[model samples]
Target: MGYFVNVEPGVNLYVEDINPTGSKTILFVHGWPLSHKQFEYQFDVLPHMGYRCIGLDWRGFGQSDKPIDGYTYDRLADDILAIVDALQLDDFALVGHSTGGAIAIRYMSRYNGKGVTHLVLVDSAAPTGFTKDTADHFLHLALNDRPKMMREVTDSFFFQYATEEFCDWFFHMGLQAAGWSTAAVIELLRDENVQQDLRQIVTPTIIVHGIHDRVIPFSQAEEIHQQISNSQLLPFYYSGHGPFWEERERFNSLLMDFI
Candidate 1:
């Protein structure tokens, strides 16, 4: 159920499609320095519930092709469009996390939410990008010592206890990405703002953010909720930046209810 779809010449993205013929379809886009594999917990259960779960690794991350350029939000969103066309996906729920959430917002506005039914943003880095200082710090760390940066990010990911083994696994996932790609994306997250894109969205949207999120604070989520006329914000009190994994059962239940 996993394969690669060509987004452009010499650029193919890795996709994990489970329950391909299920009654409903949900397309997932992962965050920075991670792959579609980040949604392993959701994929494990949603497929059994008769939902077709499709997760794609954007270019330069996961098993996807890594090129020297095309890391901008617009280009990344175009990549999603290519997958949508290739799969002939329609009336599907779109879910995105962190930087993936920002890309999802771009996709919705740029494509006018063509085939999307419901939109979900989990601890998204959107409506606004990271501050220049924070971005600079991460960029420097990524360029010089990526492992250290990944370890720091992993440490701030969850509010709940994660085993040492689990933290190592998460850290390695970031390492799988190309260093150049990682730096390029951090730049995009610093430069690109999606407030206007939020206004263009006509799809019913839900913003699921952790109150204790250190990466993208809860205040940003509040701003996202305010900009989208039809959107609602749900705070994860007992979670940090990764409510999806920190509170998987509740996150999955919320998705089922919303979609």
Candidate 2:
């Protein structure tokens, strides 16, 4: 079940935590304007694999605090560090998507990446700028023409990778929750591009991406694989950005093996 966690004094952080009493733990970090709920499918299936899965709702999203101050990467990364210490998790797997991916990378670079035994990046942002023009071009559509742009993104993020129902809850989450402002999300996106170099991750990393991912094409994953000295790439042929949603079973199997 999910809980209202106090990552720090007066800081109410929300986490969709499920400790199946498994020996191994996996901490799933979500991206911008979304909650820990993004990993719902993962939580449901990973446990049976003898693993405990936990997903965190980053600040400003889900039930977490959304104060006007402290939305920067340094601040977000700090929150993650706090959660790690608060929960007393160790030897866990760290999986992140999109902006969450950047946060994980930053965490590995800044801190010792405590308790992180393995890393999985799902269509995560590179430590640099991507097709900003493509994303920028869709801003008006995502705001002014939200439904239309949502459909397009849904197709690329998951529908192209799996069945229609795979992304039903994804769009539902957007409708049920108060989303991030366009300006704030745009600012986050602008900063999501990495300015620092992190091509030398010292851990076992698995970079996964869908072949048809319009957001960050497969080439981006290729670059990530080539750069991370100890990492490997696992490509999905018929998926998009949210490959886990598209091919749930396959995604789970791959994760089980990788972990």
Candidate 3:
């Protein structure tokens, strides 16, 4: 029930209509390296329960135009804002994974509580190191040595439970995503500090962290829950970064209850 739609000039966005007829709207944002389709589980299940779930591929990741510009997390956040305005959606649940979590957090800061009713971060990326070492690490892997180092980086990005097929699809997908400039990735990986910390976030929030998530680590989730007042955390015992894939049933159950 989802299809590609032109969201902007030269920036055709991939929009999946999870629940085109549902009354409640769910806005889902994907992590790095994957497109809007990453939230396929939510799109499939949430809509059946009467929620209009939606997900979008960040520019340069999915069907969205891999333009040379608009790679900055700030601009990416702006893109989401534009989508909300274009769709005229109000009173929706917001969910994001990995870097999408960071973008969601930034978006809330700029447009706090306008339409977002709840916030969910699944194995999110936040409250982490934004120092020289982090930048140098990502830079060396993504930009240095013909981008071959991205293989190792991508490998660690997911948990060992990830399949060879999934890993292949994920990495190759990022490469084919077109026009993902090294400078943009570096800037994103370098100045990736959150403009708005989770501590200031006051909406009803849920943090889902996979215990074996070596990518962001469960400790980061714990720290975020600790900082973000009134937020709750659900530990996924059998999954890693993408628990929605590794532990799909349990993820659906938890999300359904929360919603």
Give the per-residue lDDT digits (tens) of candidate 2, residues 122-181: 888776533566557556665576556556655556535355675665665544323344
For 1-259, candidate 1 gives per-residue lDDT tens digits of 9999999999999999999999999999999889988899999999999899999998999898999999998999999999999999999999999999999999999999989999999999987768999899999999999999999889888899999999998999999999999999989988887878988987999999999999999999999899888999999999999988999999999999998
**Candidate 1 wrong stretches, greater than 4 Å:** none
The top-ranked prediction according to lDDT is 1
Question: Best TM-score goes to which candidate?
Answer: 1
On lDDT, who's better, 1 or 2?
1
The digit string of per-residue lDDT tens for model 3 on 65-165 reads 67778776678778888788777888888888888888888788766746888888988878653356765766666655534645764666655467788
**How does residue 213 of candidate 3 score in lDDT?**
80
Of the pair 1 and 3, which is ahead by TM-score? 1
* Clash-forming residue pairs, model 3: none
Model 3 lDDT at residue 102:
82
By descending TM-score, how would the candidates be arranged? 1, 2, 3
RMSD, model 1, all Cα superposed?
0.7
Rank by lDDT, highest first. Answer: 1, 3, 2
